[model samples]
Target: MSNLPTINTDTIWAILQDKISDEVVNQLVWSCLGYIYDETKQAWDISKVVDDWGEKYPEPPDFIANRPPTVKLTRSIPQENKQLLKEKLGFKGYKLGEFGPRETRRATAANWLLSYLETH
Candidate 1:
């Protein structure tokens, strides 16, 4: 039910494997678990816990930020048109459907392209 991002246990385990001592990991996990399960606190902050851990120890690589950007080619394009677009645009680092802040020209252009495709 929480809107917060889910923590990856596998990544945590990977980081804990050889980076930090078992005692430290156990202590941090127990502290966070206590805050989460405690009847009165009614709050949890995995990010904060991880950040603190990173401050005291080696930081883990940020997995989410490392994911490659993807774009949805929303329409059926003719080979000629696709090649033409590629030639003109040099298709790189574009995420078609994932527009961020519609005020930007790139986002607006993508929106216009989608609308144009939908109409055709």
Candidate 2:
């Protein structure tokens, strides 16, 4: 986690320029740039075990098209006012049955940024 926002390719290259391997970057792209691995042989083979990937999905989905949009609370409210709002509100950041690795990662990263900004 970092104080910086979640990234895209240009930002990633700008931040990581010359400090990484192409192999690792490509693997990361493969893992995160959205595709499903279809391995029928493993599912068909008696000797091999097949996994459903345990309900996990690619974040950007060439697989599941159901990923929710990123949310932004863009208004700049005073800290005291924000605190008051929080005290008055009971809000759901996520809906039931919508939790996934991608969602958790996003929430955790944003939380990290918020905490870091508060501290610094």
User: TM-score, each model?
Assistant: 0.19, 0.27
Q: In angstroms, how far off is 35's CA in candidate 2?
A: 28
| lDDT against the true structure, each candidate | 0.31, 0.32
Candidate 2 has which clashing residue pairs, if any?
A: none
lDDT of 1 by residue, 32-112 (tens): 322232346554334443223333323332221222111222132333444332343333433667543321222222332
Return the clash pairs for model 1, or none: none
Task: Identify the runs in model 1 with alpha carbons over 4 angstroms from their true place.
Answer: 1-16, 35-120
Per-residue lDDT for 26-97 in model 2, tens only? 333223323234475432122221122222322222211122322212122234433321232222356679
- Output the lDDT of residue 72, model 1: 23
- Stretches > 4 Å off in candidate 2: 1-91
lDDT of 1: 0.31
